[model samples]
Target: MTLSVALGPDTQESTQTGTVTSTDVLTAPDIPWNLVIWNDPVNLMSYVAYVFRSYFGYSEAKANKLMLEVHKKGRSIVAHGSKEQVEQHAVAMHGYGLWATVEKATGGGDGSGSGKGKGKRG
Candidate 1:
């Protein structure tokens, strides 16, 4: 008895196969995530706005608007992306002395649909 096998485009086949079944790997798409900046007593309002501007490349008006939201709402979703992306942003925010976190986006949309935008200087 002799056996032969063939590989075809990410699949395997056997010449003496009893059952040739192909299983397609269904990979889940990357879920959307949110980078939330929380209100903190230590950081000044201006500093937060500055971070938004310098780091996120947000316009002065937009930065101030988001900063105001963080101040009043106690928290604001500043950026949206994949989980890893948002996590990196969170770490960067921490380095800037800003309170930040990452959360799975609601409804899989770009966060809460409020203050929905992302800007990177680079």
Candidate 2:
């Protein structure tokens, strides 16, 4: 009796027929996560911006930008890094009485649904 095997178009089979390696098996690391602060009834916008400036050391313009993103879009990514980093940011934001959470950043781009709003107290 005889047996035969055929490899796919992209594969070359050795006569010895050892294991095959797939290029697709390897992938880049997961995208870094982010700590997102959402606009909420409980926190003031000025406080949120101040927290960004004080804790994250963001410039006034940058802090105001992120704060505006949160207010208008309903949410904005306040920090980015590994899960531990994001969690730390979230905790610190919470300490400041802001609503924050960690989430995986969308693939290769900022995810949709962030709104736009001018800076205003609360």
Which lDDT tens digits does candidate 2 get at residues 1-122? 11111111111111122222232332333234657777787688888899988888777887887788778767776666556767888888888889888866443343331211112111
Model 2 Cα displacement at 47 (Å)?
A: 0.8
For model 1, residues 1-122, the per-residue Cα lDDT tens digits are 11111111111111122221222331233344667788878899999999988888777887897798788777777776567777998999999999998876544433332222232111
Clashing pairs in 1: none
lDDT of each: 0.62, 0.59
Top model by TM-score, which number? 1
| CA displacement after TM-score superposition, residue 44 of candidate 2 (Å) | 1.4
TM-score of 2: 0.62
The Cα RMSD in angstroms, rounded to one decimal, for candidate 2 relative to the true structure is: 20.2
